[model samples]
Target: MTVTEISRLALYGYQIPLNPPLPVGRQRITSRHGLLLRAITDQGEAVVELAPLSGTDMDGEPIDGFSRESLQQLQDELTTLQPQLGSTAALERAAGQTALPSLAWGLGLLALKLEGQLTSRQPRLAPVPLIYRLPNETADELVQRLATLPRDCRFAKLKIAQNDVEAELRLIYALLAARPDVRLRLDANGGFSLTQAVDFCACLPKGSIDFIEDPCRESADCEALHSALGLGYALDAPLNAPDFELSPLPGLRALVLKPMLIGSPAKVQALIAAAQQLGVRCIISSALESSLGISDLAAFAAQETPDEAPGLDTLAAFEADLLVSSGKALCLELGQLPLLASWEAGC
Candidate 1:
């Protein structure tokens, strides 16, 4: 069998406007910018997107937060390294030396797609948390939104650190009462200390929450809370930590894997296998990429964690997208997307 190789590389840049401007930390992002990579092989062509968070505004000032690198950084690196990336193995080697996780993730997907690994799979629905938007949204409004959720929606996520614990509790109770069949997933994003996390978890209705993600800054605090209250916890920010390890930590219910933040596909797959061996669930999530990126994520989720519903309820934020229409069930075609730059071995 002839070994397939990347015969050509085509790069395109896109700017998808976000209505209402996405709020990240203290910065507000008006538009999302990134690169689309199309890798052609003897078999066919595969496309992937590398849109980092905190993309620059019209003033060229980075929004600051979420992602470490900017879209310009990825473009520069890929342009300089385009010649050497002729195969999946070469891309992996290049990614191992790079500091950009988003680039590696995009290359990984492209490699997987070219190798016919990312086969299309049925898309699953993820509950959009009512609390992510509208900081001052009332419990009644939240409950009304909860009632609007699809009948088959089995899980919902909520942001707890944004609001006071008491007010959040009332909203949670309201959501539970309104849709008793749907379970709740709470994420603190490591905004709380040990004491505050404990106090907050103490007030939660027992057996109602699916898990609390990054409840505390310290892993020891998470373990302590789990031991004290037996509330399940999920690891999110810790996955990005330099010392991250997949252990069956006390109260570790799941691992929230964001491909954009995580390294390459191989590295992510290794983590998934190791995590599964420890009997922990892995939930593939998104960092608010356009429909193109989300389509790849859905394919990845179906290929890797078929049973778990991914946290991909983020496409609703984009004002518009390129090629594919906006939504979860989307598949990107290389011919459909516009191109900006191209390179080939013989060209």
Candidate 2:
């Protein structure tokens, strides 16, 4: 197999339902919104799908940093460059681009290279845990739903915001009462003030909650929140910003990596390596990407040794019909999710 020709590119937009609206910090999400990038070879026999994070909005808007503009620009550039270079060189150049779509493009290009070479190695994809979202209904209903999930799904995450402290806490208590053996994590999404975050974490019983993520507004709050909660803390949105320097947040247990927001895999790997050196755990999570993007992230996660169970379970929030009907399944077993197919035609 040799680098002979480049073919076509296609972008597909998809909307999938969330069983129950997912509440995270100040935002209430009811569906998974994203775009899929497909690269086809000249042979017309190979295809690679890349799903970079398109945020919650499917249409390109607000053209700011980390917006859909980044993806569009990368696609335009790749289309222009593909005709000028061979397969391997194109992939290398695509991988090194400064644009946001570079990671997804690189992953897709690598998959293409593998197909061209007829390599038997399958792209790595680890099982992602499933996360269930609770509706804004009664705590009893939420508990009942939890009881219905498969027994192997013993780890779950819930969203909290500044306004719903009491309700959230009550919900947490109810969940614990229903399944005491489950590990629970709270994602605040920077909804609380420093003082409020301290008070909120302090209200929880020690060891009842596993860890809380991004409760406060500033990176500086990591130490303060850790002290207040008397438990481990993780950073999500804070890590997404490039201006924020990466250092070990005191009392931090895990650092969540969102590749689309961070721009590239090498950069994410660097952060993960730094966190490990500082004795902090690393977790690779998605920003509600399509299966294309999720597949790439899952492959990267499979390469990680001793990584924490990531927030990839957010996939369950959507209806399955929205995805390609013939691809891999997203089922979880013993808290792990299996990888989906990379090509629709079995390339």
Overall lDDT per candidate, in order of appearance: 0.77, 0.58
Question: Any runs in candidate 1 off by more than 4 Å, and if so which?
Answer: 23-28, 56-65, 124-131, 135-137, 326-340, 345-347
Worst 10 residues of 2 by lDDT: 332-341
Name the regions of candidate 2 deviating beyond 4 angstroms: 1-25, 29-33, 40-85, 101-136, 243-245, 305-307, 320-347
lDDT of 1 by residue, 1-347 (tens): 12368889989887767765665533457777778887888778877889877556545676543678777788888888888888877776776667788888887777677777787774555523434554466678868888788888888888777657788888889889999988889988777899998888999886888999888878679999998899999988678653577877878999999888877887789889999999999999887778878778888998888889988876666776555675434434556556778998334
Relative to the unseen true structure, what is the C-alpha lDDT of residue 54 in candidate 1, on a scale of 0 to 100? 59
What C-alpha lDDT, on a 0 to 100 scale, does residue 83 get in candidate 1?
A: 81
Q: After superposition, how far is residue 87 of candidate 2 from its true place, in Å?
A: 2.1
- Residue pairs of candidate 1 with colliding backbone atoms: none
- Residue 252 C-alpha lDDT in model 1: 90
